[model samples]
Target chain A: MPEIIRFGDRGILVNFEQKIEAEINEQVIRLSEDLLHQHGDSLLYTIPAYCSLTIQYDPKRTNFKALSGSITSLLNRTTSPATSSHRKIEVPVCYDTTFGLDMVEVCANKGINSATLITEHTKPTYRVYMLGFLPGFVYMGKLSQSLWCTRRRDPRLLVPPQSVAIAGAQTGIYPSEAPGGWNIIGRTPLPLIQPDAEEPFLFKAGDLVNFKAISLQEYHEIEEQVKTGIYNLKVSYGF
Target chain B: MASSHLALYFAKPGLFTTIQDKGRFGFQAFGVPTSGALDQAAADLANQLVGNGLDQPLLEVTLMGPKIQFQGNGMIAITGADLSATLNGDRLAVNQGIEVADGDILQFGRPVSGCRAYLSVRGKWIIPTWLSSRSAITQNGKHLTPASIVQKGTTIRIDTSLVDPLRSSSAAIHPPETDPGIRVLPGPEFDRFSRFSIGEFFSRLYRISPDSNRMGYRLQERLSSFSPEEELISSGIIPGTIQITSSGQPIILLADAQTTGGYYRIANVVSQDLDILAQLKPGDTLRFSLTSFEEFS
Candidate 1:
């Protein structure tokens, strides 16, 4: 079941059944699409989290009570579909010492070899659960349970942009230069945010991602390709 | 045909003054903060005086305003603070528009009343807009350097065609009292606080500390109780988040606040009362009153 709650005067939160199941995520995505199609102007933005979709709107232009009622009624009437025809994006990553600052530390804590860790990480296909904390930063999930670990107690002052990290069943990429506590194991050459580009962000919520490992030489090559706008990222649809 | 410009030279940028507007909305999901004028009342009043729309851009001068010289005949209004303003060595009136010709220098001295002031010209000032707002976010460390004051030799370009001195007028709305009774609504985590702490929060006369800025206002108060948990999973925090730190003192978040925070939010100040809280300076004492949205409306 989906629930709608009040968040201050100008925002409303549409929460899905509190579970990490794929069906719930698909429902959340469908709700996001429905909200966009129904009331585009009333909403400022919709943030889709793991099990919740927070909608922010301008109070001056929107009536909160009416909007909340509409959302609740909409969710109640809509049934969950079995399949999610969402897009899948393949993200190329370099899991080397130069960009992966916490790789050695993570390896020491997990008692796993660098090669073995990299192989395990890239082997599985991941689902995009949410986009939050920073712009273009995605929270992907269902990591191999064995690889699950908690975040660093003391957050690093600066985590370089595009750094891929993992902590407590969650894996994400740093959209910009920011302070973070996640254990960094790899880095992506693609710019998560290209302000001047036609489509600024490389990924979106409900998108599937597969991190393909590349060598240090390939990393430099891809970085140059990204800089020169010569690289093309493959995106396929999943039913 | 007539064209005019204003020149303001900075002798000293009193605190942090910058160009501000209503704020940039619809960008927070993209990791962009909606930064704008700290005091909306002042910005709105400035816009009203100049016949600009309520959401139009205005200069948010903090504590003191820039020393400006008129280049042509125009009308301007100063609101927000009683900054001992003088026009060409003569005292100028606050809250009302005044006409100034070429060579007239407008000087704003020390603040005798409020912490920030708004200065508006008859014509809209031409400033570049980023993300649909002219408001400066200092935390980004992007624009507006060490100089907080719009100083001498500083050219402020204006669209003279938009200037209509005849349309200038006074704001009918009176400024709210500085020592305001701040109203707050119970938050999601209001139950986290001890009973004694809740009483003290309402009973104590907390002084606005000097360590206050656009991000948040730290209140100096002695709390009897506090929660042991210092960290929480990062969640959505808005402008009015009254988060109590590990030390038990309350800090009210404001415009330039971070997108997310982990602190426990005991209460949220209503939107109507935020203007009253913004005018508070160091040494000003405020008392909290718990109220609901229905009561506030």
Candidate 2:
């Protein structure tokens, strides 16, 4: 059972566990979905973190006491483990010299050649833990231990859009041009976030992602097609 | 149907200017920051003075102030910061509804007091909203208004049809000139700090750093250092949550703070007192007063 603590007069924080774990994250998402199901009108929204869920409510419509009671009851009812029905997304990356800014530094730090570094980086199917900091900037984690490296001592003033970067045990693609500290390893041309779309961002939490190495030419071709809103990347559960 | 819009052209957009309403809600799960008026009380007062609903979008001016030309006639109210303002060469009154004549140039001079100001018109501005908010310059994938900074060529469309009966009467408030000690409550990781560190936090006067922006206000002084044995996992964060960085300096997250953070949050600023922090410019000195939950609860 999670410990429900008062976040503010209008919010509540449900702490599932103190530490970060995949199971905890899964439970957080599951409980969030359940709460959304149970009290759709009462809650303004719920923020599901790695090990906890924070919910904000309408002060006039619902208070902490009533909302927490419903949440606790919902948690008690849902005993089964999370099904983890997350979709698989395949993203293509071009680690060419022109696009990969920190390739040399990252490869040197990992004590591996460019090809070996690329191979190891693409092998794992990364999970989308949560999207924060920037829109469509997926914070995925558990990068190969050998591939881990310290973050930039001095962050770049501007990192271009679709710049796939890594730092420490995590990796993600910058959805837009912004200042960032992560080490850029490659670039993906896909527009992970479309501001005009009803659902701006492409992926949600628990989505599994696999990066495929593509040629620079292919990256540009996909970029052109994506700009026209006609390109759709291949996503399959079995793959 | 009546168009009910008043368009204004910006000639000078001061240091920073953005459109803000009450706040953007129900999108924190996707990591969207709750972009809103930095000083909610001022914005609300500005809206009320103009006889508009509290949730109406208003211009939030920071530091210096914007120079604008009203394209249509409407009642306008200026509140919060006393940005020395003049409408068509006539000294503008703060916190009072003044009718703007078409083609009248409204310009703000050097800030007389306060760091931010609110400009509320009687009707609505026809700006597009993202994630159910009109607030600007956030990381939440919201498209920046063409002016974004209320640039020279940008024209903001507003509703001028609604006549606020209280248009002639002026409402004014004298914001305190002296530094009012900020009130704060213990944060989630408040227990992790040593008793001495806590004492040091409240005892020392802190200055707002130059690097501060909409995302957060970084304080200049470093607190007593005590590195935690364990890393704080990335968790939910709200505006006014003061998180200490690795260097032991405090950063008070503000209107545009990210929805989640991975730092040890030592305290959170109460909503009522947040305006005091908002009015503080860089190099301004402020001290914290340990406020109990009972006062706020």
How much RMSD separates candidate 1 from the native structure? 4.0
- lDDT per model, in order? 0.74, 0.81
- Candidate 1 residue lDDT tens string, B72-115: 77777888877788998899888887777878888878788877
Look at candidate 2 and tell me the lDDT of residue A95.
96
DockQ (0 to 1) for model 2: 0.55
Deviation from native of the Cα of residue B147 in model 1, angstroms = 15
Q: Summarize candidate 2's per-residue lDDT along A1-239 as a digit string, tens digits.
A: 78887665467788887765677788788878888887778787787887888887777787777888887887787467636566799999999978899999988877899999889889999888887777567888768888898899999989998899998788888888889999998999888777668987877877889999999999999999998878987876632
Error of 2 at B106 (Å): 0.7
Residue-level lDDT for B231 in candidate 2:
66
Best candidate, DockQ: 2
Compose the digit string of candidate 2's lDDT tens values, residues B1-297: 576668888888778788888877777887777778999988988988888888789998987888898887778889998889899888888888788878999989887788899999888667787777777755633343333346656788876675445533566586755656998878778888999889999988898899998899999999866576666778888778899887789999987888888888888887778888888888888998887766632
